[model samples]
Target: MTDSENIKEIKKLGEEIMIGGVRFKSNVLMAPLAGYTCFPFRLMAERLGAGSAYTEMVSADALKYNDKATTKLLYTDAREKLKCVQLLGAVPTVFERAVKSDLIQKFDVIDINMGCPVPNVIKSGEGCSLMDDIPRASKIIESCKRSGKVVSVKCRIGMNPQRIVIEEFARMCESSGADMITVHGRTRNMMYDGEPLYEYIALAKRSVSIPVFANGGIDSKEKAEEMMEKTGADGVMLARYGFENPLAFSLLTGREINDTKLSLILEQIDIAEELFDELYVLTYIKKLASYFMKKQPGTKRYKLDLYKCGKVSELRELCTAIFGSDDNAGLV
Candidate 1:
């Protein structure tokens, strides 16, 4: 098929995917972003069109210690059909304990985050540092697999542009018992910038028999199609842009989305309020609204006003102003 034809063919209603016998409604999915992908956010993405979404990366260390704050992050509702939690850790024994923790026991899939590029995560011998240490990464995956839950993994192609380990790492994850893998087609040093190396993701896809989801820089329906076409991944996971543009899922996947920004924002507020205290709700919503704020015009003043607003009532008003402003009605 021509490039144009290929793009049109993959429009949203892509194939159903079976990962570890847990079938997803469609191939398109939402990737977890730290401090984002809260239950409400994940819910909105699912409502908008994503087949399933993972929670923000949870620290295995926190789970091991039974940290209240970390447990709070694992909250899920029955509304979400497929619940997945991503764990960030390097130690094999810690993962072994974490998979059995009550905090994440309800989750259907446990995703090991081996691709985080944050400096502190790297310094601690976690995240992308594990890419260079395949033996430890493999052991961690093996430990998590013991949970008897469908275990998956997310990782980068290599440590730097100079080092490409897609083929080797992909094989390791499969042999270590990962049911699926999401390959962010970039090195650790590239962070979130630069075009994702589609060829590398393709290499991983070909190297592994398990399902591989292509991640990184897929911000639009067209990009999702292109990523799938280029990498031959079973599906594409929407990340940064997916957080800000939940509508991308509906647009790409043929999922019906009757809700508007104002309606969804209101729903998120109600849910957030129920799960968190007033101060936490205000701060969390304020941080989340910032992403939406970047999408609207005339947000300069509201962005400044956002930090100062601390009450639920005040946050609702600020969000309404920035997201549901008169001049930006249609944009929302």
Candidate 2:
């Protein structure tokens, strides 16, 4: 078959996926971005065509203790039907408490984050470090499974030394009760700096009994289709590139982004204001513009001007000037 024909086949296969009998509308998942994958971002991704979304990796210990701030990350709206919450912690006891806690009980699926490469997360013996100890990771899965909820795991292929244990690790997760596994195709040491090892992801897909999703370096529709064809993964998860272009999700699924980038920025501003205080909201709008304005000429100057604005009105005026004053451009 030709490349276009292969993409068509992949798109048809991507329509929906079932994991542990829990069905998601599509298989194009939004990988959990620590500070950015909040309710509003998830909502926007879903609106743009993400099949499923994971919460920013929350601390299981925080949830177990009923920490107010941590509880807020569990926030959801009516539109996010296939809600999945990813938890980070090294202890089975913490996970047990989290699964039984009210905050986590609301999610449709529970994901364990064994993929984070951040120093703090790894130093605590959580995140990608778990891949080094399959037994402990298994125990964590078992703990989450006790809730009778669909349990899943997200992990990197290996650690600094690059042992290539993804295939073995995935099988262990499946045997230990993981409904699905997401393999970020880089060793913890490589950390998003290079191309993803598609062969390792393919190994993971072949090794697991349950569903496996391939993540990393999937920045375009072509990359999505390529990963799907190369690894034969059940799904593909979008990360950094999705952060830069929210409409990339819709485009990946062969869907058009009918709205202008300016309108999306405006919508992001509204969502930010609703979810945070004025100062934070202003900062968020500017941060978002940093990505949204990348394709515009004199991008540095635009960002500098946006960063100088102290109030929402200044931000609005700058956006209007940059994107024009058409209010109807918001329609999608």
Candidate 3:
């Protein structure tokens, strides 16, 4: 099909996706990125047209133990009409306790993390490790589903050179009561360096009756449209691309990015101030700025300076220089 024909087809299937009983407004979802998809970031994506958004993976063990930091990650506001918290860890009892907690009960959906490829997550036997033992993973999903919230799982294609077990794994999750499944096309060993094996995602889509979302390396609107057409997934979840283009969801939906880059950054700073102390706000904003400016022209000369900024004001000044006025240049 031609590009317009492809987009026309996507528009029909990508409008919305239902998981369990929860209905999201759109099918362009923001994936649960480790450090990037916080409250402010979710709000930004939702405003930009993400049908749904997920929290960064919080540790189920941490929530079970009442860790203050983990509790804080559950923060939300009215703007995030459709949001889910992604929890990491392998303990069923711990996950059960977390699901039953009052804090977690606030979310309409609870997503379990079984796709992380980071060594630390693997060493803890929580992420891709779960794929090695489907029985144990099924138990965890059952435990989370007991809370009466819409439960979902995010997993990779396979652990390694093994057969890409996504079709079987997705079926296992559905049988275990997972309302939806997200399949990252890369194997655990590939990390983020390769093309997502869409064939595997397509297999999972065919195997499951529940909603399936395709994730991993969907970095542009064309890719989003193409994935939907190729895999017939219910949705497309964007990760690293979101860090560079917070408005990607809008673009996928054929909407323009409506805010200036400077405006977007300032708005995030405001939300950060409301949620954290000065130290945290500055550190987090700098981290976000690093990703936003990584590919911009003239950044190599001032990247270190931007990193060294200790306050939001200094960061704003640097961004003003790089992005110029809002009327002249936006995040595009």
TM-score versus the correct structure, for each prediction: 0.92, 0.90, 0.92
Report the C-alpha lDDT of model 1 over 1-332, residue by residue, as the tens digit: 44333332232345678899898877888998888888888888877778789999888988867766887789887988889999998899999998888888999999999999999999889988999999999999999998899999999999997888889999999999999999999899999999998888888887878988989997666778788877778888888878776777777778766765666677889998988888778877877777766667767787778889867988888777766755643333
| Each candidate: RMSD | 2.8, 3.6, 3.1
Question: How many clashes in candidate 3?
Answer: 0
lDDT of 3 by residue, 41-100 (tens): 889888887877899999887876676687668888676798689999988999999888
- What overall lDDT goes with each candidate model? 0.83, 0.81, 0.81
Worst 10 residues of 3 by lDDT: 2-11
lDDT (0-100) at residue 67 of candidate 2?
Answer: 67
Poorest stretch of ten by lDDT in candidate 1: 3-12
Which has the higher lDDT value, candidate number 2 or candidate number 3?
A: 3
In model 1, the Cα lDDT at residue 132 comes to 93
**2 or 3: which has the higher TM-score?**
3
Put the candidates in lDDT order, highest first: 1, 3, 2
TM-score of 2: 0.90
For model 1 the TM-score comes to 0.92
**Stretches of model 2 off by over 4 angstroms after superposition:** 1-13, 325-332
Give candidate 2's whole-model lDDT.
0.81
